[model samples]
Target: MGEEPREHRLATPEGDICWFEWGEPSDRPSLLLLHATGFHARLWDQVVAALPSGFHVVAPDQRGHGRSFRPASLADWTANAAALLPLVDRFAGRPLIGGGHSMGAYVLTRLAAERPGAFRSLLLIDPVIMDPALYAGGDAAPVPDPADHPIARRRDRWADAEEMRARFADRLPYSRWQPQVLADYCEHGLLPAPSGEGYELACPPALEASMYQNALRTDPYAWLGNLDAPVTLVRAPAGPREGGLDFSQSPTWTGLGAQIGAVRDELWSANSHFIPMEDPARVAALLAGIAANQG
Candidate 1:
């Protein structure tokens, strides 16, 4: 049986980051898992439970999300990378296995590039790093106004977690998630509302909107070639047909793996961008395989 995750909080220059740990503390190889925007570290609970023993796992609730501190400026995606550096440095002497999904994946790539020896291998699942051509000539992608975006304008207050779950149970993305996964999301995704009447999303709607609006500002392509560790990219097919729509279609640039000298570029034709949440057990097996190969 997998151990229950131990919660922790680490103070950094950017803010206090909340995290959870699983497995033996004395394990030889350690894994660092980063959650996507608006998600928390506990979201990886099922995936951690399914993994093999002998590897320690660390999953952090990134800034502006979950229980972590929200920074004043929510526009810069690179700030997320900067905030995580101190934690990466803490594991300098040990071999680290790093992996992330979506925005988290992009942050891991940036960290690996900035500190080459931080991780022995990387698993990037449907990262949002786009093609440089799209932002060439100093042209930036247009961001939707926060006031106009539905995510920003979402209802935050719910009578309880159960009420929140019931409200979203039949919704598009939540409907696709497994029962336990959806329950975990509800349990950890909400905080007591300020008015003490109900629960509110840990990551406020406007902050999530800001993350999406400024996502394209940082170009991961600029630093991907600098990483020395082996990389494995597990990508899903473009959205709408599989389950639901995502921010990008085939977000990983064509031939990006080759350009970055990645060891493996596996494509799951049947899965959607939310592969981590959709099939966490598969992700666990992949991580176990990667760790075993390194051993």
Candidate 2:
């Protein structure tokens, strides 16, 4: 892996979108990465490093959290779109590979569906596709996420070690994690609150839950099927919710796997929801192979 610069933030109308551009910027069809809810672009560093040399990779921190905080609206989605067209225009209008994890994948699918011909393909990781109403059994909009459910929001302090680590571990699917990854998640993922005794999560529980509610109203299959470019879905075999929410399935992974077969190609990651953090090498290899065939 070549030494790469740390991620920088892009000034957008909605908020400053945090992103890191690595490899040959002149490379055609840049790789645009969209991370899952509650996480940032830094999570993709290990995976991006393993990508083929000369391939440009741009990973953006979405609205509401990370470096891109506040004043965010649905228009923020447009900013997500802005991150792409200009980048791709610089590279011979090469097919831009739009890759995302969890809610990142959910929003990317919306982008592909919203504009069919603009992007080259879709790469989703353990995407959240079910409507919040399904989980709530017909609750109105702004549904609370299961993990961040009011009860789970009560932390013992501004930085409670036992509480935070336990909750973080509870969110993940696997019983074990790479030591560094686990530590990094715990350190960067939490922030001190006014309480001064323990820490609260950096991402807003209500806002995060609301984003899922907003996405569930839209259908990925309906929206993504309209994409002009082929689609490559990288789904998780299983993991922590990352956003502290359970992914209520519609047809479930079993059915979506069959449905996603309609796409050009689909690879399964069979780990946890935090695929980029957990299995970036595998993802890098899969994406590299697919991009090669498409090229």
Identify the candidate with maximal TM-score. Answer: 1
Score residue 259 of candidate 2 by CA lDDT: 60
Q: Which stretches of candidate 1 lie over 4 Å from their true place?
A: 137-145, 239-249
lDDT of all predictions: 0.81, 0.58
Measured against the true structure, the TM-scores of the candidates, in listed sequence, are 0.92, 0.72
Report the number of clashing residue pairs per model: 0, 13
lDDT of 2 by residue, 1-295 (tens): 4556466756655456666678755546777778776666666767776777778787766666655655433323344445543333444445678787777777777666655666766776667654333444232445345454452354434445345556666454423454445554556556676666567665556555555445444445545446566666655454333343443212124345456553743444445556666666888887787677665
Poorly placed runs, candidate 2 (over 4 Å): 72-94, 131-148, 151-171, 183-200, 212-215, 237-244, 247-253, 257-261, 264-270
> Could you tell me the TM-score of candidate 2?
0.72
